[model samples]
Target: MKKYYLRAAFIIAVGLFISGCAGKSDLSLNIINGEKLEENQLLTTKNSIYLVNGGDGMKTTYLSVVYGEEIAEGSGLAAVNIANEQLCAYTAPVVLEKLVITEKEALENAKLNQSDYVIYSRVEKWTDPLGINCTVGYYTDEASVVLSLYSTKDEKLLNTTRLSKSSCPFKINNIPVSTGSAEILYEELFANWKNNMFAKVSK
Candidate 1:
C-alpha cells in the first residue's frame, strides 16, 4: 500500500511539472522571407554596417492602458544593442537614430552614412506583462520582431528573419516575475544568425 501511494505521488508531480512548463513558454522564429547569404559576401572586413530601427508603431492592444509606445521603442533599442554587441566583434557597426518604415528609407539612410550594409530591425507586436488580464491568471508576455540584412550597393536584401517569444511568469513572493523579454529573443536570433555566417565564410 505504501509503495503504491508513493508511485502515485511521483506521477502527479511529474504531470504538474510538465503542464506548468508547457503553459509558461511559447517561442517561434521563421526566415519567412528573403534569400540566404552567399559565401564570403557580407562578412568581408571592408563592409561597414548601418543599424536602423524600422518599427513604425506599437500595437499595445490589451496593454495600451498600462504600457505605451515606449515598450515598442524599447524593443527596437534592444535589437540595435544586440546587433551592435554581436557585430562589433568583427567590425564596428554604426547605429542610426532615425526610425524607418520601409526598405527604401533604410537603404537611403545607409547610403547617407556611407555604410556598405544595413541591419533593419522592426518591432511588430508587443504585449506587456502588467495588464488587466494578468490580474486574473497567468498572463503571457509576447513580443515579435522582423530583422532584415541588406546590401546598400545594389539595394539587395540578403536575409530577413521574423521571430516571436511569449512566456508566463512564475510567482516570487506573490509577485509575478517575468523571465522573457524582447531583448532575450533578439539576442538569441542575432547570435544564431551570426554563428551561421561565421560558419559559411571566412571573416
Candidate 2:
C-alpha cells in the first residue's frame, strides 16, 4: 500500500511538471501599411528622427516565460539603439533621439521636438527551441521585427520595413541545462537585423 501511494504521488508530480514546461505564450502586434523607403533615401542630419518602442509580437512555446520578457524589453530596444547608432555613423550624420513615450504621446513629442520622422518598431516574432533529447540537443533562436517610419508633420505613414534573422543550430551536450541560450540568440538576431538594416539604408 505504501509503495503504491508513493508511485501515484510521483506520477502526479511528473504530470504537473510536464504541464508547466508545456506552457506557451503569445504576443500580438499592431501592423500598418506604408511606403517602403529606398536605400538611397536614408535619413540625413537635416531630418530629425524620433524612435519609439512599438512592443513585441511573439508566439513561442519553449522558454516562453523567459523569452517573452526579453521580447518585451530586449529585442525592440536593441534594434532601435542599433539603428540610431548606424544613423549617426552615416556619411551625412543623422541625429536620432530616443523618445520614451506611449503611442498617444508620440505625436505630441514629435511636434514639440519638430521631428521630421518618427520611427516605431516592434518585435514580430521570437522563438527559442530546446530539443527533447537530454544528452545531445539541437537549439535554434529566431527574432523578427517590423519598422515603420512616419511623418510627424502630418502624422502620415511614410515607409515600413521588416527584418528577421535566426541563429545557426546550436548543439548542446546537456539538454536539461540552460546555457544562456536565450541571451545569445537575441544578441545574434538583433545584431544581424541591425547590420542588415544598415546595409539597406546606408550609402
Candidate with the greatest TM-score versus the true structure: 1
Worst 10 residues of 2 by lDDT: 22-31
Where does model 1 exceed 4 Å of error?
Answer: 1-23, 42-46, 56-74, 98-102, 130-139, 170-178, 197-203
Q: What is the C-alpha local distance difference test score of candidate 1? A: 0.65
Off by over 4 Å in 2: 1-32, 38-42, 57-72, 91-100, 127-139, 169-203
Give lDDT per model, in order: 0.65, 0.54
Per-residue lDDT of 70-165 in model 2, one digit per residue for the tens?
333455565566666655554333334453456557767777877777777666765555543311122344556777777788887765666554
Roughly what TM-score does model 2 have, to 2 decimal places? 0.52
Error of 2 at 73 (Å): 4.0
* Candidate 1 residue-wise lDDT, 50-165, digit = tens: 88877533545454567644445566666666777777776655656555457788888788888988878887765555522333233446667787888889898878877676
